[model samples]
Target: MTDVPFTRTETPVLEPITMINAFTVPVEESERFLRRWKSNAEIMAGKPGFVRARLHQSLINGAELRYVNVAHWESGAQLEEAQKDPEWYANTLQMLNDPELHIQARPSIYEVVVEVEPGARLLP
Candidate 1:
């Protein structure tokens, strides 16, 4: 096969902020936690810099961590702004103060180094 030269197009890269939250919830209270979590997600989705949010549940029958939340924001400042909102604060406090659910959240922020798209060629 002969190599053909193709013009490469470069698009602006986005350095969006990412938040990962690991949650350990009691098996029996998983549904209730999901409901509350969804409501919280909706509130975040309405924020200015919010990109998207996803919640993942462990498929293992007896895993230590029950759920993991991954959310994307335009920047860390935007995430902080969302957290400062009254509704967001209230919902967070409610989740933290709830006794029946026994929910624990371990949250952290991250920055992307590189991203590859399917069917896209990498140019040197």
Candidate 2:
């Protein structure tokens, strides 16, 4: 009889939710939007249930969707609470209302149905 010399780590299974926001901005105003976006991101990062966030930029110049933000939260409630932070709200309002930026945003929360990683086998 032989025993494996390894220990398995146990982690809680999470039904996490994702917050995705797609933004349309003029090419010229991208910098301004990014600056304000960074500030807003910082506020979310400090909130509870925030797992992580990534902002993606489109390769095409002057694309309709200039930037897309994808963030993960432990629960929808936590994400909603974080978004209510006064500083974040003010920053978001200012950024969106800035005529120079002319940004349009489509934001929503989603639940992941399935995920496939590279080199992973499909289940039967």
Candidate 3:
């Protein structure tokens, strides 16, 4: 009898939840903060428990763009824990130098109740 060197095995790890939040910026501030915004996104992507994210810029002629940051985590606890790091504060400060950028933001937490199966539909 011999044992295989490699075999399929399952190990349990903390599975996190998906969090979606939107950041609304004034129309006048977009140009001033574009670089800072990209940098912040890159920083968050490098954090632990990060899954994926997308930043959406609004298309409305005169409306400010809303940057939606979505991330999947192992748990709400993990998300909350990682956010307490003081490094987050340093990175966040870089985002505030732009005078045009409104310091105020509207963010919300959501728990997904149901999800529909994915479909392949292209927008026109």
Candidate 4:
């Protein structure tokens, strides 16, 4: 994906929605889980409407979820359509269905209701 300039100076269009996914995985299974997730992420990164994505790992070892993924898309429809590709779907399903890797995923979509721009507003 081309790097888009981060120079917009507007109220920030809310066209691109966000997808948040949390993953619960045991420490021992983290390697396997991450490998599968990486594969899936690479495929998704090449899809249309895929603006950007980041995966964050908890600093605390005992955090409930090991990883949280935040992805931005032009729209939910486009994101959904991107994942519907036959090959992508099959690959994703294979990872999900793997018995050895019991990864739990909680995914949700959200629209931006508020935002704090950098150095844009004075401290309250």
Best lDDT among the predictions, by candidate number: 2
Candidate 2: give its CA RMSD in angstroms. Answer: 14.8
Candidate 1 residue pairs that clash: none
Model 1 C-alpha lDDT versus the unseen true structure: 0.76
What TM-score does structure 2 among the candidates reach?
Answer: 0.82
- lDDT of each prediction vs. the true structure? 0.76, 0.78, 0.57, 0.76
lDDT of 4 by residue, 5-117 (tens): 11211223337788888888777888888898889889999998899999998888788899999999997777777766777766677776778876767777788887878
Clashing pairs in 2: none
29-121: candidate 2 lDDT, tens digit per residue: 889899989988998899999999999999998689989999988987777667667787777777777767777787877888878999988
> Tens digit of lDDT per residue, candidate 3, span 56-111?
66677455435666667665665666555566645556566444567444444445
Between candidates 2 and 4, the one scoring higher on lDDT is 2
Per-residue lDDT tens digits for candidate 1, residues 1-124, read 0122211122123457788888888899988888889888888999988999989999984777889999988877778767777887677667666666777777778777778899877786
In model 3, how large is the Cα lDDT of residue 40?
A: 65
Off by over 4 Å in 3: 1-15, 118-124
lDDT of 2 at 48: 92
